[model samples]
Target: MKGMFNQFGGQFVPENLKNALDELEKEFNTAVNDVSFIKEYEYYLKYYVGRPNPLYYAENISKDLGGAKIYLKREDLNHTGAHKINNAIGQVLLAKRMGKNKVIAETGAGQHGVATATVAAKFGMKCKIFMGAEDIRHQSLNVKKMKLLGAEVVSVTTGTMTLNDAVSEAIKYWVDNVNDTFYIIGSAVGPHPYPTIVKRFQRIIGDETKIQIMEAEGRMPDYIIAPVGGGSNAIGMFAPFIGDENIKLIGVEAAGLGLKTGKHAATITMKQKGVIHGMYSYVLQDKEGNIKDAYSISSGLDYPGVGPEHAFLDETNNAQYVSVTDMEALDAFLYLTKKEGIVPALESAHAVAYTKKLAHTLQKDKIIVVNMSGRGDKDMDTVLKYLE
Candidate 1:
């Protein structure tokens, strides 16, 4: 699948890793099309990860907004408390099928690390997770969870010490140890096979949402909204609906301090076409084209580049990308907790904040679905410190 997604995705890795990537791509293609493999994956999704997650209508929030009715696609209710598990489970299964006995991954915000660790333990595979030092400090609880699951958590202190740094470190490690180890990328941002593979697994989000929304409203929603970090959740939610021209797809990125403050991760909104993490996409860079450090109160959203597919979507106008500030996200997080008794992940709060802004502009009959990608338990420490 090299140069897939209309030339937007291709393997841009070094010579040493090309063969491994090729092998991965071939195996993934075969696995996805195999009926038995699909059945086994579906079984785990159904029994272990708890498939067909709820689509709950936020009555109080909608009533408060007095415009569009809001429905939450509750991925937060998944076993690992996030949408990351969907991809992790699929990749770990693939790793087992490929006869790999160890799995590795890079994570920010810790949700993906926990999800990866959980699956590795279930399959009895050795797990190693690379996380940014700063993220480790902010998401201490998640570190404990990963450790409890018996995965080695390595703190990466390179380049801004955030998501991008961890990604670089993970890639380096994968390049060196490509024989018996499988690298499970947490998001849609990566080389050819990874973005495609992650998106394929996570597309279950859009597939389920389509059925649930139609049953609930008797029609498809006017818009689908999701937060874009590495673009996994957003791409998953938007993939199934892309062909439906009437349903608008919106991706919200985090504006750390503010967009103009030079401390934001609003990649699609503020970036230009560039390659980072082995795929060409919208990247946060300086005048010299050096990738800049992205900052976001939401650990997951702190990345310098977005997924290649997101860039393609933006380029083709299939979806719109917008941004929400740290303060705006915080307000939405608090508002949801007060109004609906749901505390969303800070990353998810960006989408909720945008929903609040958009709801008031549309008519009351219009419906909007937000991918509540993760719960807030993983964000309590950061939230508490910010609130204090």
Candidate 2:
């Protein structure tokens, strides 16, 4: 499984950080396979985080398309209202076991920050979240929620004042407070153990989907579609089936307008090889290799870079990526909410919009599963104004 990942998933850090990465790798390996870890994780999954979110067959939308059959892996139903909690709970438990008393993280849409703060409260650990000043404004409710949870929300007003800037600030904090602070990255985009660890935590999405599909339809899905932000939800859904070879994995990036419009967040689709956040990855950058500001209707997907693992998968032809414009994504957001009675987050609607397009191209007998990565509660105001 790891071989399919190539150079994209390798550890890329200074010699000084090698030991920490090694320790993290060890903890991840143990947490993933240990019996005690499994038991504890299951307890949280059932009671705290909520697992096995329903695989709801969207007959209405599928029939309306008159193409492939459609189903939703409802990660939106999980506790704290998104898949972010899964990784946050798992990582927080690990931090507690490691004797860490403080948790630090960076968030974009504030979903991950809220999840981290939620877990920190549960674990009674001090929590701090770094967010770009721009993001803090857009996701102010999340900042308020974090404060209510007793977590500090530090606004990063540096370069571009967005996700990457917030991440850089978090890294500086981690460097200064390494002993007592555990940096819990929001997605699978970071270096080494983070990509591996976050992917493992989110892989339950795929695991549950596989079983649900078999029981519900007596077969695996023909294609899996997920929105790509830091690429956690997409990679998580793709990882369990990486070796299957038959399951087509599709990642949808946010194209704010169009790729050529130069206002999109289609990193893998429009960007080139570059390094960012201590890893070699595909970054939305200029000819001089300077990272450019990214735009998306979904703040979560408004990142200027993609996970290295995703870059590798794209290069190796193991997965395919495409883009959805803000208009199309918004259309799908309303389509699902009004038609299916599910208010999907704009981030997740990127996947929905792509799936709707793909559905038209597929046979009616084919099955497609889309990961509903989050709920629309956080995006209601933005979406309502778009409708207005």
Candidate 3:
């Protein structure tokens, strides 16, 4: 709960927005402890968002990996078909409780946007999503999905026309219309309260995993793994076990080509210190501190900068960070679908790939939990084309 400003979570918004952030922080802090708030939130999580998603043991995958046990935290089964829904529902409910009438957000692969739109419909609030022009083209399916749910998706044409630009545009929108608008950032990577807020919402993954592990193995997992884009999924899977010394948290980043090839989204794994989109964190940057371009087959993981909490975690050694290239991730994606009958999102496949590599080093009795952050149905076209 300490101020993480030094690690990229301080006030970075305009003066007019500072008061709103303060109010939001206050509300979030109070809501965390309020019994009625907790109960209501859990109710939505259970009935509306589908809580306690199954944790399945991949026996086939384990056998292929020399019998290294692999347990999947099936976040893909959550509402909206990804972990994004968890934070979206939580934030929308918070916005409603706070008397907000509008919700706005930025998204890349459109999963977050769709999830936000779904919650807005549930709460009957006006919703707007800002996406990069390029993302609109690559993620048109998600855009259509959002529109079907009555959310307006605006395309940002400036800058790189990608996730970062969409976020910048969303912030501008929020600034211009701050009174009744709530900007629901998709990841645990924004300035103050956001990293904390999103992580708290997504912590259900870890919470459920803890109980499942206790019930299944009679012991906690030796490690928890998830892919790191804006780091929400990874933080979600790690937050509940943060204070436990026995559990190790691992985050796999996208090494689009290879780390030295300078084309990957492996921010914390290879980047140096810099500031981007407001916070000081490890960024893929050049000598002038300008963010460098990043590439990844997974649209969700293609970012030049990582979440601030992830940077902090890497620095403090609270978690281990690894990177998997596009080829490696693709292979893992195919392997899971063929061997285990699970088609994993390319972003999530990065963690699965790492898990495969680490199987040789781990004892057969030791448990390793990987978050299947999303389903790969949206990426079937990309996969088919790649294979062709």
Q: Number of the top candidate by TM-score?
A: 1
Candidate 2 lDDT tens digits, 1-388:
2312565656555566666667777887877788998789879998887787899999899988889999999999988888899889889988987889999999999899999999999999999999999888787788889999999999899987888798889988887787788889988877687887888888889999989999999998989999997898888889888867888999999989888899989999974877677777888998787998888978899998888889988998889999999999999999999889999989999999998888988888899999999998889878878878
Instruction: Give the alpha-carbon lDDT of every model.
Output: 0.93, 0.88, 0.87
lDDT of candidate 1 over 1-388, digit per residue (tens) = 4755775777789988888888888999999999999999999989999999999999999999999999999999999899999999999989998999999999999999999999999999999999999999999999999999999999999888889999999999998899989999999988888998999999999999999998999999999999998999999999899968989999999989998899999999985778888998889999999999999999999998999999889888999999999999999999999999999999999999999999989999999999999999989988888889
- The C-alpha RMSD of each candidate to the native structure, in angstroms, is 0.9, 1.8, 1.5
Angstrom error of the Cα, residue 360, model 1: value is: 1.2
The ten-residue window of minimal lDDT in model 2 covers 1-10
> All candidates' TM-scores?
0.99, 0.96, 0.97
Task: Assess the local accuracy of residue 291 in candidate 1 as a C-alpha lDDT between 0 and 100.
Answer: 91
Model number with the top lDDT: 1
Point out where model 3 deviates above 4 Å: none
- lDDT-sorted candidate list, best first: 1, 2, 3
Give the lowest summed-lDDT range of ten residues in model 3.
Answer: 1-10
Tell me which of candidates 1 and 2 scores higher on lDDT: 1
**Which digits, one per residue and each the tens of the lDDT, describe model 3 over residues 112-209?**
99999999998899999999898788777899999999999998999778887888899888889988999999987766778889999999999999
